[model samples]
Target: MSNPTVSRIELWHFGAPLPEPFWPSWIPGYPMTENRCTMIRIVDSDGVEGWSAGPELIRERRGLGDVVGLMLGQDATDIDLAQQRLREVGYFGWKNWWIEPAFWDMAGHRAGQPVWRLLGATEGGEVEAYASFGEVRSGSQRIADAEARYEEGFRTVKIRVHEDEDADIRQVTEVAAAVGDKLRIGVDANQAWRVSAFADAPQWDLDRAKRFADVCADIGIAWLEEPLPMDAYDDQAALNEYSRIPISGAELHTGGEPELRMMIERGCYSIYQPDAIFTGGIDQTRRIIAYCKEKGVTYTPHTWTNGVGFAVNLQLYTLSDRDKPLEFPLEQPSWIPECRDAMITEPFIARDGKVQIPEGPGLGVTVSQEALAQYGEQFFVADA
Candidate 1:
C-alpha cells in the first residue's frame, strides 16, 4: 500500500465569546472580550484527519493557505520532510511550527496510538492538574479564587504578580493564608515575554528580580517563574544558583531547542517550560524533554493558548517527568473550560486535581461541527 499523502488542508478563524472581559496577567489592563485562534485541519488521502490551532489577533492568516498547502502537500508520514519544508517556508514567508503538530496527530492516528506512547511514555494514567490563574487581582479576590479552586480539588495553583512589590506580597500572603499548607503555590512574574498592548508593563532589572526572588523565598513560594526576561541567560543562571526557590520559565522563546539546551548547560532554571505549539513543534519539544532529563532538570509544558493548544501540550506532558503539575489556564467568568474548549466535542474537566489522558488514537480529540457552525468562519481551504 502507498504511504498516506495529504489531500487537503482547511483553516478556520474561530472566536468564542467570553462571559466577562479577561485581562492577562502578563499584559496588565488589556480587556479581552473573546477567545480567538486560527484552526488548522489536514486530511490525508486515506481519509484520516488531524487538527491543531494557533493564537491569532484577527484573521491575519487568510492568505496563508496557498503557501501552506503547496509546501505541506507531500507524504504525511514523512515528519522530517514536513518539518524541513515548514522551516524552508519560514525562511521566505511565515514559520509556523504550530501547524506541525497536526501532522503528528495524523501519524498517531495511522499507528493507532496516542502521541505520548509514540513519544515513549510507559505507564499510562492521568496527569496532575494545577489551577493557573491568568490575571492579577486584588488580595481578597485572589484569596477567594484560590479558595474556590481548592474546593474544586486543585491541590496546586499559580497566580500572577504585576509591578507593585507590596501588592504582590500581599496577594501571595492572603491566598497562602486562606489555602493553608494544603496547596502548592507558584508565582508568575510574566517578565519572560512582556506585552504592552493595553498598558505599560513593568520592566524588571536583575536587582529587582533578585529582590522579588528573595521576597518570594521569604513568603514560601513553591516556584518563581519568568522573574527576568526570557533571553537573560546569564542573569537567570546566576539567580537560579542564588535563589532558595525553584526558578522556571522560557515558555514563549522563539530560539527553539538550541537556546534551551544552552540554558540547561548554563543552569538557567530549575524547571524548564516550553510549549510544543509555540516553540518549535513536537520534535524540538521532545528534544528539550530529553535534554532536561539528561541534565537533571524538571520539564513541564506551558499550556495557556486554547483547548487544542492545551490538548497538544497535554499529550507531550504525559511523557514528561511529572515532577510538577501541568499548567491549566482557568479564570472564572471569562477563561473557563467551556470557552477554552469551544471548538472541541467535549470540554476537558479535571477530577480531584487530575485530568484523564484521552485514550483515543492521535491527539484524542475531534472538532464538533456544531461548534464550528457557531464559532468558526472558514477563511482558507485548498485541496492538494
Candidate 2:
C-alpha cells in the first residue's frame, strides 16, 4: 500500500450550550453560557479522519481552509514537514497553531499508535489532577467551592485572584486556612493576559506581584501562576528570585518554542505551563517539555479548553514528568464535563482527582457525530 495522503480539510464552528452562566476568571465580568470552538477535521485518502479544536474561536478561520489545503496537501505522515509548512503559513496570516494537532492525529492514526506512544512514552496510566476553578466568586463562595472539591477527593485545587491585593489575599487566605495542610494550593493571578475587550481588569505591577508572591509564600501556596504579565520577563524573573513559591506562566505564549526557550533562559518563571494547542501544537510542546527538563524547570499543561483541546494537551502531558498535577477544569453546574467536552463520545471522568490517559489511536478520544451535528456548523471544506 502507498503512503496515505491528506485528501481533504474541513472546519466547523460549534457553540455547545451550558447548563448555567459560566464565568471564566481570565475574562472577568463576562458570563459564558456556551462552550464555543472552531473544529478542524483532516481526512486521508483512505478515508480515515483526525480531529482537533480551537477554543472560543469565532469565524476567524473562515477563509483559512483553502490556505491550509494549499500548504498541507501532502503525505499525512510527514508531521515535521507539515508543522513547518503550517508555521510558514502563519507567517503572513494568522498563527493557526490549533490546526497543527490534526496533522499529529493523522500521523498517529496512520501509524496505528496513540500520539503519546509515538512520542516514546510506554505507559498510559492516570495522571493526578488539580481542580482548576474558573470563576471569581466572593471569598466565602470561593472557600465553599474549594472545600467541596476537597471533599470530592481532589488533592490540589487552583483558585483565581485579581484586583486589590488585599482582597485577593483574603480570598486565598480563607481557603488556605481552611484546607492548606490537606491540599496543595495554587493561586492564578490571571494577570498574564487580561481580557479588556469585554471589561476592564486589574493589571499587576512588579511590586504588586512581589507582594502577592510574598503572601503566597506566607500561606504556603504551592505555585503562583501568571502573577506578572507573560511578557514581563524581567519583572517575573525578579519575583521568581525573591518569591518562595514556584512562579508559573506562558500558558498563552504566541512566540512558540524559541520564545519559551528565551524566557526559560531569562528565568522568567520556575514552572512552564504551555497549552499545546495554544502554542505550536504537539511537537513544539514536546520541545518545550524537553527543554524545561534540561533546564530543571517544572512543566505542566494548561488544559482549560474543551475535551479535544484537553486531549491534545494531555497527550503532551503524558510525555512530560508527572511532577505537577495536570489542570482539570472543573466548575460545577456550568463548566461541567457534559458541556466542556460536548463533542467527545465520552466525557473525561476523573475519580479521586485522577484521570487515566487514553489508550486509543491519535489523541485517544473519538468525536461524537451526534454532538457534532447538534452543535457544530461546518463552514469550510477543501479536497486535495
Candidate 3:
C-alpha cells in the first residue's frame, strides 16, 4: 500500500462581502454585488498542509468533498496525473483546475524547495506593472480617470474599451493626447471575453476587431488585449498579420501553448498573456513562456484574480522577461489592496510603479490568520 498519513483534501468557502457593487463596465448589464471566496486546502502524507483560493460569486460547492478526499494517497509529485484526475471530476459538476496548483505546492514542500525553482527558473524578477483599469467609464470621465491614475504613480495603463468604436477611438485619442509621451497605453476591447450573467454583453467578431485595430494604430496604442473571441484562433491569427501594434489574447484559453503554437505558426499576438490560475497551472504556463521567448513572442502573466492568484502569477511574472510589463490590478476603494487582497498578510504594493519578487519559500506571499478569521470560512479539513 502507499504511504497514507494525511489522506484527504478539503475545499472551503470564505463568505465575504465587497464594499460596493464593483460592476465591471465590460460586462455590459451585470449589476454590482459582493464577492464570495473559495479557498483550497491540500494535506500531504506527512500532514503538512497547503492552501490556495479564488474569488467566488456564490458560496455553493456541495460536491468538492467527494473529489478531494479520494484524490489523496496518489503520487502528488505527478502533476500531469493530478491534472488528469481533476479532469475526471468534471464528469460530476465542478471545474477542478484550482486543485492542480496545490499539488505543485505539495511537491515543492516534499522536494524541500520553492515552486519557482521547481519550475526551472533561476532568480525572481522585479516586474514593471501596468495600471489596468477595471471600470470602463464615459469618454470624458475616462480621460480624467486616466490622469488621476497617472498621478498615483502609474507610468503605463490598460483601459477597457467595450463601447462604440468611434467613441472609444475619441476617448483613447484624448487619453493619449493628454498623457503624450508621459505614459504607455494599451486598450482592451473586453470583447474576446464577456460575462453572460443576467444582462446582455457585447460581442466582437473579426470585422469589428480589425476596425478597432485601425484606430489603435492611428493613435499610437501599445497593444490590444482580447479583441476577438478567445477561441477564434484563425481570426486572432489574421488580425496579427494586419494590425499595426501587436495583437494579444488567450488569457482564459483551454491550452495556451497549443494555441500559442498555432498562433506563432500563423502569426497571432506579438504578446501572450496567460494567467497561471485562470489558464492552467504553473507547469503549462511555464512551458508557454519558454515557447514564446524562443520564438520571439512576448509573455506576461495576468494577476488580477485574488492575492494568492496574484502572488502565484507574480512569481511566474518575475521569471519571465523584464521587458514584458506585468499587469498589477489596482482599482481602489472597492478593489484595492486592503480588500481585494485582504486575506494575504502582506498585499502587493508598487514602489514607483514596480513590484519586487521575494526570495522566500513557496510563492513568497504570506496569508494572515486574523484576516482569514475575519474573511474566511473553513468548510472542510483533513486529519493529520
Model 1 poorest 10 in a row by lDDT: 64-73
Q: Write the per-residue lDDT of candidate 3 for residues 168-273, one digit (tens) a residue.
A: 7777888878774788888888776677675777788888888889988888889998888877778888888889898887777645456656766677688888
TM-score of each: 0.97, 0.97, 0.91
Task: List clash counts for every candidate, in order.
Answer: 0, 0, 0
The TM-score between candidate 3 and the true structure equals 0.91
How many clashing pairs in candidate 2? 0
Query: Which residue segments of model 1 deviate by more than 4 Å?
Result: 92-94
- Which residue runs of candidate 3 sit more than 4 Å off their true CA positions? 1-6, 91-94, 110-112, 382-384
How far is each candidate from the true structure, as Cα RMSD in Å? Answer: 1.4, 1.3, 2.5
Distance from true position, residue 349, model 2, in Å? 1.4
Q: Candidate 3 at residue 22, lDDT? A: 73
Q: Give candidate 1's error at residue 142 in angstroms.
A: 1.0
